[model samples]
Target: MKRPLLTRLLALAAGSLLLSACISQPGPAPRATGDLGLVIERASGSVQLIESTGQSSLARIEGLGDLSHASVVFSRDERYAYVFGRDGGLTKIDLLEQRIDKRVIQGGNSIGGAISQDGRLIAVGNYEPGGVKVFDAQSLELVADIPSTALPDGSRNSRVVGVIDAPGQRFLFALFDTAEIWIADFSQGDTPQITRFEQIGKQPYDDLLTPEGRYYIAGLFGEDGMALLDLWYPERGVQRILDGYGRGQQALPVYKMPHLEGWAIAGNKAFVPAIGQHRVLVMDTERWQQQHAIEVAGQPVFVMARPDARQIWVNFAYPDNHRVQVLDSETYEILADLEPGPGVLHMEFTPRGEQLWLSVRDANEIQVWDPYRLELIKRLPADSPSGIFFTSRAHKTGL
Candidate 1:
């Protein structure tokens, strides 16, 4: 009780200093991870997380179902990835934690999926069950199941392809057997506003929606033309473009089906691969008419344009699968020819189109290149990599 005044004054000053420190101190910042990229290992049923810049694998996630034709769509924040597997397994992967958060088997066979414009729903296209299923993006809960039952015979099953998100909480897809285009609007309620445009085309294989989300184009497998739907004016229904494009021409045996994802729009023109043919159908988007056809070495599998629209890159099917060619978008001249070796499954371009990444399955490697210079920069090892998807696609319309 007989403490000195100096001791009491020192204690009071220490208390004041501690209070000031607590008020001004800050917490640790959130973890700063690099731009993460995923490489789908087709045969091994695993995914390799790699840096988009460094080209190094950071982690590998396994136990994903049959990944033979797996594709991934990322969450709006890019923290999670919803992978659509061929064996009907939908896996929700946490990119930051490098593990599976939730998984479910929704069907017998699934092709691909798309995330909604609002980032609240995930819709998958099924081949076995022959319909599309919508799910809650966060919990992966089944929300609605719209079976493709538009066949003439009243069959409850019809394969759905090219399931893609559209504006106004809607989805656009094609029926493989019924040759119809169906639009499901979910903005109103769980019972979607369904709009069916029948007889759109013969055996519509795959479709692509324009960057502006205005046009939905589907390629016909039974015929040479493609069906175009003006989403802005749904009253016009579907119009056929480039009719009889393969007329009077002998077709080649396609070892691998051509993907409409290969189709690209550069400036005012769209470059489309001619099915069972060795040419690319160039169309003027404004008029939707065929402008010219450029001949290539083999049947084109993927025909994509550079971001700047200065050039187009074309990949071929078997017998010519090992070759890749670049073309001048304006003059249609062959700019470069590259043989990146066999089993080249897919390719992706940087946002600015400055660089390109290609997956070579048989070689078990991913190749990065400077397309303008036609030089290989990096070759990273992979396990039968089939698809190279970037997080940058999260904002795009028709990814």
Candidate 2:
């Protein structure tokens, strides 16, 4: 109280410096997550967060349950990943922090999930009890549960497959056991307005929505045709396309079901894996008619297109699982055949299509390739990886 003015000023400065020193320092430099991705290690029930630019693993997140058949979808902001595990686990992971933000066991068995167009709702399709559960994106709270139609015996609900989000906050899915397709409109509220399309086909195994979200096509396993619905004109009902695609020939035993989500579109042509056959069916997208059937090395699992729509890359099921072939889009010629070791599970293209990332399960590695040059660029170690998902999917519809 009686100190000189200069002495009091010096004391105040010393106290301010001490307070600043006691405060916690910043942890790390802020960075963006645009180039980040994840690789699913199916056997270990974990995911490896990776950086696409460096083609390197950044962190390994563990403790997810039963990832034998897992799929992932990203939020609209591309900051979080929603992993749908076979054991009904819906785990929300924070990509920036490399940690699980929230998790819930929504069903007994789940196939996959999709984020709503508005990015506010997460929808999961289940297999065990068979239905769809919609949850709040932020809190992972159950907002709605729409059970599939009951089976003939009334013992259990029909298995749900091919869940995808469409325009106007709507979800479209196929009921495998009931041979039906349903559209759940969530624009109203938590309780969605349901529209059911009956007798779609037998065993609608999987489905895909076009990039523009105009057409929804479901592939049939019990028959040789596909069911297509025009989302723009729901009143027209479902139409059968590519009926009896087997051409009256005896079908071969299918080792693995060809995934419809791997459907490829180049210009006006669509390339799809033919079930129980060693061929890729090319269709004219305008008419939805089979244009050509290109013979391949084995039963094709994934027939995916390059980003520029210049070429298509195909992977096969066992015992031809070791091979991958690139095909010319216009000429329909086999460009290259690559043997990147065994068990080539999945392939994903970078945002600009400069590079392609593939998961080789048996080899336990992720291979990065220059798609245009058809050259191997790098290899990163993973544990029995099955699915390689990039954040670019967050911007695409029905991914």
**Per-residue lDDT over 1-399 for candidate 1, one digit per residue giving the tens place of the 0 to 100 score:** 778999999999999999999988998766433367788999999998876677667888999979998888888888888899999999999988889999999999999989988899999999988899999999999999998875567655889889899899899999999899999999987678899999888899899999999999999999889999999999988999999999877977878778887687889999999999999889999999999999998999889888888989998888888899999999999999899989888888877777798988889998988988989989999999988887777778875
Model 1, residue 170: C-alpha shift (Å) = 0.8
The worst-scoring run of ten residues by lDDT in candidate 1 lies at 28-37
How close to the true structure is residue 278 of candidate 2, measured as C-alpha lDDT?
88
Clashing pairs for model 1 are none
User: TM-scores for all candidates?
Assistant: 0.93, 0.95
